[model samples]
Target: MDAEHIRAIAQQTGCTHIHPGYGFLSESPQLASLFPEGGAIVFIGPSTGTLRVASDKMQSRALAVHNGVPVAPGAHVSSAEDVHKFVEGLGSAPFPIIIKALDGGGGRGIRLVYAEDHIDHAFRRCVGESASRRVFAEKAFVGPGWRHVEVQIVGDGLGNVSHLWERECSVQRRFQKVVEMAPSTLPRDTVGHVIEAALKMARHLQYKSLGTFEFLIDDHAKHWIFLEINPRIQVEHTVTEELLNIDLVKAQLQLSLPKASLEVVLPAWTMSPQPSPPPGYAIQLRLVAEDPHKDFRLSTGTIGPADVFWPSGRGVRVDTWLSTGPYYRGGLQWAVGVDFDSLLAKIVVHAGTFQEASARALRALRETRIAGDVKTNVEILSGVIAHQDWSSGRIYTQWLEEKVDQLVQLGNTQLTRQSRGSLSDTAAPRRLSGGTESATATALLQPGASFQLSLSPSLPQAASGQQTQKHTLVISSIGRNAFPNELSGTITTSLSAMPLSFSLSQLSSIMASAHTEFANPADPSHVASPIAGKIVELHPALETVAGDANKGSYVRKGEPLVVISVMKMESVVNAPASGRVVRVGRGIEVGNIVAEGALLCVLDVTDMDKGLARL
Candidate 1:
C-alpha cells in the first residue's frame, strides 16, 4: 500500500484523513494499521483487525461459521494435490468446483474447474493471479436459478449496525458483476433472513464504516450460503444510494470520526427495527472498455472528443472519469493498460418499477454513442437489459455468460436500428465554418491512404487580439472499407464539435490500419497473441523445444500454449493446430508485455483437420 509514500504525501499536503475509495488498498489491513489510532492521519475504513479477517476468504469463512452462519464446504489449499483431495472428498457432490484466492475480491482471483483434467491448470492460474499465492477449493453452486445477493451494512465500531436493504448482483461475466440492482426480487421473508444474518456478523465483528455482506442463494432449493464480506465500499454502491436516497460515501466518512455512532450518523428511519421499503428500484450497468466479440478482451486507445457521447435526463446518472481531450488541457487522459482497470463508467437509473427501470436503462444505453479505436461493453449491457429473461427476472450469476451470444446479437440489432434512425435524422450534409466544400473533396479516399485532416477552428478574438484556438484531427492510415455511412478510420482529435461529413463511397473506403492484415486462415505455422497483455505462464511443451527447430515438441490442437494477463484478467493462448513447435517467438517469456498480433510461436502442423475440428 506504499505506507511511506502515503504518509509523506499526507504530511506535505497537511491532510488529516485518507479515504482509499474502494479497491487497491481499501481493504488492506496493512494500510489501515499504518495509521494507528490518534495518528497524524486517519484511514477511513474498518479496523486493521476487521480487515485481516474479512480480506482472507478462509478466515472470513471461519468467522461466519463461528457466528452460526452457513458457508459452503471449502478448505484452504496451496497445491493442486490439495485441490484433488478436496474434490475426491466431494465424491459425487458435483463435478465442477470453484477455486478462489484466499485474499482475492472484486471477482479477480477465481476459477471454475469443470473436470479433473482442468484442476491443475485452474489451480495454477488462481495461484498466479493471487497476491498471496494462496487458493482454496469449495463446492460450487452452479445454476440457472441461483442468484447473488448482498446486504449493505453500516457500523460505528461499537457493536451497533444497520442494514440498508439488499442488492441483486446476478448479472455477471467471468464471475465479475456486470449489472446490479437494489431491492432483490427474493421473497420478503428470505431477504429478512439475509439481512438479519448480515447484521449478526457485522455486530459480532463490530465492523466499522460501510461494507457489503455477499451471499449466494439457490432459488430451486430455497437455500442460501454466506459468500464473503467486502470490507470496504463496493463498485455497485451507487445503486444502493440511488434506491435509498442516501449518501454512503458521506456516511462512511462520518462514521470514521471518533465518538461517531450509527444513531448519530444515520437517519432516524434507518434506525427502525424494520426500515421502510425503498421508494423505487435502481439499476446500474458497468461500462467496461472491452471487446465482447473477442471474448471481452481489454481494449486500449484514445477516445476522440466526438467519439463518446454520454446519455442524460431524469432518473439517470453516469459516473465516470473518462473524457476525450488532451490531458494537460484539463481533459480526461485514458491510461487503461495492462496495469489499470477496464471500467470506464457506471450508468445508474432509478424508476418506480423494475420494468420502468429496465426500459429507462435501455433508453439511456441506446442514447450513448462511443466510437473510434476504443471498444466498450455498451452493446453487451444493452443486450442484457433488453433480454426477455432479464425483463422476466429469470437471471442468475452465469446468465450473462450463458446467453452472451444471443444477447450480443440482440444488442447489435438494437444498435443497428439506432444507427439507422440517427442517419435519417441527419440526412442533410452539414457544412464546416471553413467553407461549403466537403471535407472529403480533395482526397481520393481508399484503403491504405495516408490522409490526415487538421481543422484550425477560428475562436472568438480575445481582448488582446490573440491567435484563434486551433484543434487538430489526424487520420493516419486507411485499410479496408466497412461502415458506409461513417468514417471507418481511426481519428486522433481534440475537437468536440459534430463529426465532419463524408460521402458514402469515401466513408466506405476508410478503415483503421490496425484492423488490417490478420494471420491468414490458411496458414497454421504461426500463432499470434489475441490481445495486448503480459505473458504470465508458458506451457512446458514449449520449453522442451525452445530454440531447437530440429527438436520439436508435439502438442494437441486447442492445448494451452501460454496465458496472458491484461487488466487483471487472464486469457489463454492455445495451440493453433495439432502440431510440433518449431520455435517460440524470440524474447517471449513470462512477465513480458506483448502487443496484439505479436507472434508467440511457430507450429508445424501435422494434422489440419484436427485444428479445424478443435475450432
Candidate 2:
C-alpha cells in the first residue's frame, strides 16, 4: 500500500495495526515508523532503527562486519567513473563484478558486469533503477557451484533472538530466486556458522517479528559470506514453514502485539530454550506467468477457463491468489496484470527425504494444468526438479543458465497436440456475399478491390531460409486468452486485389505450436513489428555493423536492431538481413505507438564494400 493510502485507511477504519505482508510498505522504514499527528498504529515488523539499517545494502553489510560476520569483498561506487577506476585495480580478474543500488531489493536494480565494455551500460542501468542514485560494486562469487543460503531469524523485541535453520535458494535467473528448498545439504558446522551469525545479527539489532539473513556460500561450499537482511517475510517463507511446522506469520503477529512472549507461543520448545529442532525436507517452485524459453518475459492476460488440480494426498500445498471458480466460460477469471510480481502461485511440497519430496513435486506438476493461452513456468520448474544435477545437489546459481537449452527441451515436451475439434468439421470459412464479388479476407486486396488469390505451391522457394509452414498464433501480447490460436490479422504483404474469409477449421487444424526461440536467426527480408506496441528502443549509428566503421553502417544477422514492448513484455527485433539500414520510420521514437506489421526500418542487402565500389 502507498504511505498515504495506508495512513488514510488506518484513520478511516480506526485500525491500530498494519501488517504489510511482504512488499510495498512492508520494508519501508519511513512508513513503518510513520507517526502522523495523533496517529499511532503499530507496524508489525521491526523498529525504525532495524528497518533503516537493514534497508540499505551498504549499511547492512557494515552491520554484518561490525557483528564479526564474514562478508564478500566489494566496494560502494556511485558514479560510472568510480566504477571504471574500481575495475581498473582488479587486475584482469575473470569473475564478473556485481553492481547494485544501495537502496534496492528483491533482485531489482542489480547488474552483473562481465566485461569492461558492459560496465558503463550496467552502471547507468543500476543507477537509474533506484531513486537514491547510490550504486555499489562487488566481485561476484564466480562459481563452480555457488549456493544461496539464508537463515530465518525471529526476534521477540527483548534481545531474545532465535533462528529456524536455513533455506537453499540458489536456483535463480536475472539475480532473482525462482525455486527454493529448505534444510541445505551444507555440513553441520557450516549450518551452525550461518545460524550463529544470523542470531548474532538479530540479537544486536533487537529485531522483532520475522526477518531473513541472506548469505552466499562459495562454489566449493566451504566459505560463507553475509549478503543482506530482508526485514520482512519473504516469498519463500512457505518452504521454511512446511519443513519446520512453524507459522511465521503468527509468530510475527504475536511478537509485534503488546506483551506477547515467544516462549508461550512456542509450545514444543526444548530445554535449550530454542524451538524444537527443525525437521523434514521441503521444496517450493514459484509458478510465474512467463515463457522461460523466451527469456522469462511477462505473459499478462485474463486466463481463460482452466482445469485446475492440486497434488493429491498429504504434505503438498498450492498457494495462490486465484479465487475458487468454475472451469467453464462465465466463471471466475484471473486477470494477470503487470503491476505486481510475476509470481502467480507457488507449489510447496514436504516429505521425510529430499528425493521423496522431489518425486512428489514432479508428480504434482505433471498432474497440474493451467490450460488456456497463458504461458507459464510450470514446465520449467518441472524440468529443474527432475533434472539429474538437482537430485545430486550439484546445482548452483548459474546451473540453470548453463542447462537452459536442455531444460527448455524438457519443458517443450509437455506441449502435446490437442484436438481443436470445433462446432463442425470441414466447414469452409464463412462467406460474405457482396453482389457476386468473391473477395477473400486474407488476400492482397486494396480498398474497394476484389480478386482471387491462393497459396501457390509452384512459387520459387522463399529466399534460401524462410518459415514456409503457416502458423496459427496462440497467445498474443494484446488479445489475452479470449481467442486461442486465432489469427489477429497482422500480415505484411504487397499485392493487389485479393481477399478471402478465414476458416476456424483451418486454424484449428493448423495446431498450436510455440516457437520458443528468441528471434528466428535465419535472416528476414523485412524489418517489421511482431506485435502492436510502442517502440521502446531504437539503435544508434552502427559503426561495427558496416565494413567502413562509419555512422549508420550495415549490420549482420542476429544483432539487436530494435526493441518493442507490449504490456511490459519486451521483444528485441534483430537484424534479419546482412545489410545497412536504409530507411527508418519517420516518427520511430521511444514510446511511439506502432502497429503490428508496420515497417520500422528497411535493410539494403548490398554489402558495404560492394556498395562503396558502386559509389
Q: Please, what is the TM-score per model?
A: 0.82, 0.76
- lDDT by residue (tens digit), candidate 1, 426-491: 322333343322221133344343212333334433323432332212245455443222344444
Q: Give candidate 2 regions above 4 Å deviation.
A: 35-39, 92-94, 219-221, 270-277, 325-332, 411-615
Model 2 over residues 1-615: C-alpha lDDT tens digits?
478777788879988878888874677888876743234777888887888898888899999999999887778896888888888877777458899888777676788888888888778667756657798998888566688889988777789877777899988877778889998876667677788899999999988888999988874748888989999999899998898788888888888667776676554442154443466799998888777755676554444333344455688888976536464445445555444567777989999998999988877776555543346888788889878888998888888877888877775564332134321222212232221111122221122211112222222343233222322233334433322232354446533233332222111111111221112223354576554455666666332333232334556666667766544334567777667776564445676655433456667776566544433
- Candidate 1 ranges beyond 4 A from true positions: 324-335, 419-522, 540-553, 607-615
RMSD of each: 10.3, 8.9
Error of 1 at 99 (Å): 0.4
Candidate 1 clash total? 1
The CA lDDT of each predicted structure is 0.77, 0.67
Model 1 error, position 491 (Å): 21
